[model samples]
Target: MAVDLFTPLTLLLNACLAAVVARRVLGVPVGWPRTILVGLFVTFSIGSAVTSFAEMAGIVTGGRFTVSLSAAFILIGLVTAWVFVLGLVVLVVLEVLAPTGTLPSPLDLLTGWKARRRRARRYAQIMKIAVRHGLGGYLRGRRRTDPYHGTAKIARSLRAALNEGGVTFVKLGQMLSTRRDLIPAEFADQLAALQTRAEPEPWQDIKAAAEKAVGRPLDEVFAEVDPEPLAAASVAQVHAARLLDGAEVVLKVQRPRARTQVTADVEIILRLARRLERGTPWGRSLCVFELAKGFAAALDEELDYTVEQDNLRSVAATIEGIAVPEIHEELSSGTLLVMTRLPGTPVGAAGPLLAGFTAERRERIAHRLLGEVLRQLVRTGIFHADLHPGNVLVGEDGELGLLDFGSVGRLDTPTRSALGMLLLAIDGDDAIAATDALIELLDRPEGLAERELERRIGHLMARYRTGFGRGGPSGMFAELFRLVTAYGFAVPPQIAAAFRALAGLDGTLALISPDIDVVAAAREQGRALMREAVEPGAVRAWLEERLAGYLPIIQRLPRRLNHIVEDLEQGRLSINVRPLAHDGDRHFLNGLVQQIVIAVLAAAATLGAIMLITADVGPMITPDIRLLAVAGGALLLVGFVLALRSLALVFKPR
Candidate 1:
């Protein structure tokens, strides 16, 4: 029996070792306890199944397997054990060879070779594109060595490289275009023109995706489907379709294999970001890893059509003025979204029409838009984060329509309150208050000088005051971002996204009504919002909610106080005061004497209790010396409490 059990036991042990190797050496995610349990079950089941099968096949006379089947099982277990031992040996060798951590582990070398080759191919492609566009010097670090020249050519080459590399690179370039503080102004301007539009997929592919999404043929769902796409992008394409119920809806069909391709590209980008963070000075300041993480999360959210649908519903409920297209939830899937087709002209295309509007009308439109934005920031705390002109539309009836609910911003109550305060401070020209508000919004890094930060903010605000009516809130925000970068504080991605959305809106508003003061408008609107938040009724409700949590404690306070006073009157309460300048040795000796006396008393009490238990010294209760034992136990308990208190005081830090 022992011999029979040995083979399966060895197999289980080998399986456990393999799991460890996969987890530690290869970076596989096999949780330890669960993996061990699974390994044991699998090993036992395999051995038992083989033996039983052999018995059923008449290969064994009774319950044992035939010699051949027995030998095969033993041989398999041996091979597994040998493989595990060999893996351990390889791990040791790799660790020894890569003591400086410059070399990959054996498992990584085997599995990641193809990934490295792919990465090299991509790098070569990027270099080729750069050289073809006369930006090779930039890629080779020559531009950094010299002064920045040929910014236009460099920006064009970068845009081309990103477009060629795939959706991940294009998305990254788009995000960087918004960050004027990080890149040069000219580069940012050029990259902002990088087109996100991709060539549309064929009609047959769209039809197939639609059919698969609705789990039926196209005719059953759509009466008339447009063969040509309405719009095409890196993620998905929109096509016009008429539902069977005569409702005109737009079908958003995800491109075939786009998710898989984007996933791979994002992984590659994340790896590069990690390397950059570890290897370069600029990378450390930029926080490339955190940026990559946020980008990945945003991209993942964008890839799911259902998330966009949910966002649309959420925004519709929160935003009152803006029009969001109603989604047909039953027809929506992970890849396909069906929504009522909105009827309006894009905000960018309405420039000629807007030019014809009266000045009063244009001012009203601008004010309405800005008011909605402020309300989103302060009241609703949910807003369209990507409000570029292309995503916004203006109807003939003067209603503003918001499109593409893929990206939305959310702010918690505290952040919303802080933002209101910041706007108020900026408008009031209280630079110190603005600085304080900004600090409260940020996770202030250690070693940052508060006075210096306030001074710098004051200087920036002074410049704004001198150049009043020049660039408005947008310019202030740009300068603030520069300051945040200069101070080595990692600006939160959400804050950056919010600023970008506001800046875009600011430019739009400028075009609509040049005379409108966005700062003053925001301040007035923010004050109203603040007042509403702290109204009497709201304050009363808030107080009630908070006080409810402490009601029990409040009710017990009187009784607790009475008990404390009684203890004081009975001389049972004592206070110990230790002076700062007291002699350390004398204090330690006094505590030590107290502890020693308490310890001796406890020991004597315990000894007395044992003797009382053995002797008939007190009135017997049920044939036991209960009275003396109880007295001794009580004394011991008192001594223990005193000893613990003395020891605690002796060791407490001064």
Candidate 2:
């Protein structure tokens, strides 16, 4: 019977349904094999779908169709039932083999069914939320080439799903919002709201977490602790507190369930990212899985307050118009941070805070914010990774304060230098220089088309050189992300974080002063920083700090010089050369040279023989032989053979 008539289609439908039922009953992707049977089910499901489609096509084309839909269904059901009865008999064999874990992969039908068994519930929940929100198509990579490509509906839907997905997803969305290069501006704008507000954890849980983290009574740790959250977010919530002696401070308490909840969510995110990358075009281009892994690590670090404490202290002293909180290390732990409180409003919403501030003062504040962030990114090795408007507080005094050390990007000396160069080149419209600097900032992959990337960067520069709507750093950085993605390049996480921070600073600057041209201000500040850096005192300090690393070598320098001089003066200095260190290489080269010499000699011998034969010198050594002519002939033949052999040797493969 031709299975194309829908015979196999019915079997496949019945078997797949049976598998789904088993999974529903056992709480795993593979419960069908454990309970009833395996292969016949897989075979039936595949067979039914394939046969049904084929038969339908044959009928439409006026070709032979051996089976009716109803008959096919009946046969499929009967055959599957017979297979199930046989499977029951094999259950006894499985029981004996179950103890030894001997179930082979292919025989199991569904591969890696138990791989995610532990997280099956969360996995299912996430899938339901995504599907319910209609995010599957977007997840398959349907966004724009630029920030304008995403539609409002898609963005809104994603934001809603993220909100329902809980803390880790919300945080991820917030991070993506800054990455306009990776997402549409519509999506970025929508996701930014996820960071602005969320219901704070219950007061009871907050109090217990704070007290336990402090390892003392709440009263002992502070004069007063406010239950009202200063700010609520997914990772941690802040509270205003006062020290026992009456010093105002801020208390940052990690949410009680943040770690466990975020951990599970991170795992789910990683899985989703992996699946997207493997199955979708957009994921591969965006390097989605690597991005997830990087974000996961950053989220994990944020859960530990001690890391944030270290980050705060490291950047506490920098630039003139910015202030960073002084960490109270003695009372801090992996989950708690106590620090001096700075009074200010979020720069984005500093309505009343700007009352007394003059227009000039607001402009200065904007420059200060941009300059300070750039200074940290280029000059200092460690800088704030998250500099959103919510994280930067603008005071009445016009000074800005930084908050949230949970995410900071640290650059090694090389990366910092490369990034600094890259920014300066972009500002100057030197695309070639910018391309070179960008390469330095990344781990240069093999077979990269540097020239093509350079051309693309040049085009990007031309497009944005007039005026980047979103300001300089971010728009260009966003474009840069797209360019790298096009070339199949992945920006290292640290460098990417730094780029995002600078881009975010543009938004913060915009908040401080709407009229401020961020690009010009950034350019002015950048050159001014360069000037300040070259001043005598700053240069000397830089030189001194750098030279300190060479102290050991410096100490032995005079002695080394003296020994060199003495050796030269005594004529005892000698230079040793080893052009070819390996014996095999040397031998191979020597053979080549020998072959060349032999070829040349053979040519000379042939010439001499030709001259002898032409000159016809008179000589008689045998009665039947004309000695000169015959000798010439023999020499000529021998030379020809030698020349051919030399050529063969030269052309031979090893």
Each prediction's whole-model lDDT (CA): 0.72, 0.73
Candidate 1 residue-wise lDDT, 1-654, digit = tens: 999999878987866865564345322233454445544544445556655544654455665544555444543453344333334334333334433235555677889999778877766776676587675654453443322366776677777777776777888888887776676656666677777788888889878878888899989888999988988997788999999989999998998878877887787778767866665555665677787888898899999988898889888999977788999988899999999988877777788777777888878887888889888987888888887788887777677888899988888877887888777777678888988888777777878887888889888877875443455665677778879777766666667767877877876777767777776666677777778878999899989998999999999999999999999999888877866446887777776776687667656765765665455577532232244654554444444444433333333334
Lowest summed-lDDT stretch of 10 residues in model 1? 91-100
Q: Report the C-alpha lDDT of model 2 over 109-216, residue by residue, as the tens digit.
A: 466556446468887888789889988655545442332344798789889999998878988998787676576667877887785366898988988998999898
Could you estimate the TM-score for every candidate?
A: 0.68, 0.63
State the displacement of the C-alpha of residue 119, model 2, in Å, after optimal TM-score superposition: 3.9
Q: What local lDDT does model 1 show for residue 225?
A: 90
Model 2 pairs whose backbones collide: 4-55, 8-47, 8-48, 9-48, 12-44, 12-45, 147-185, 305-334
RMSD of 1: 17.0
- Against the correct fold, how does model 2 do in TM-score? 0.63
Best-fitting candidate, scored by TM-score = 1
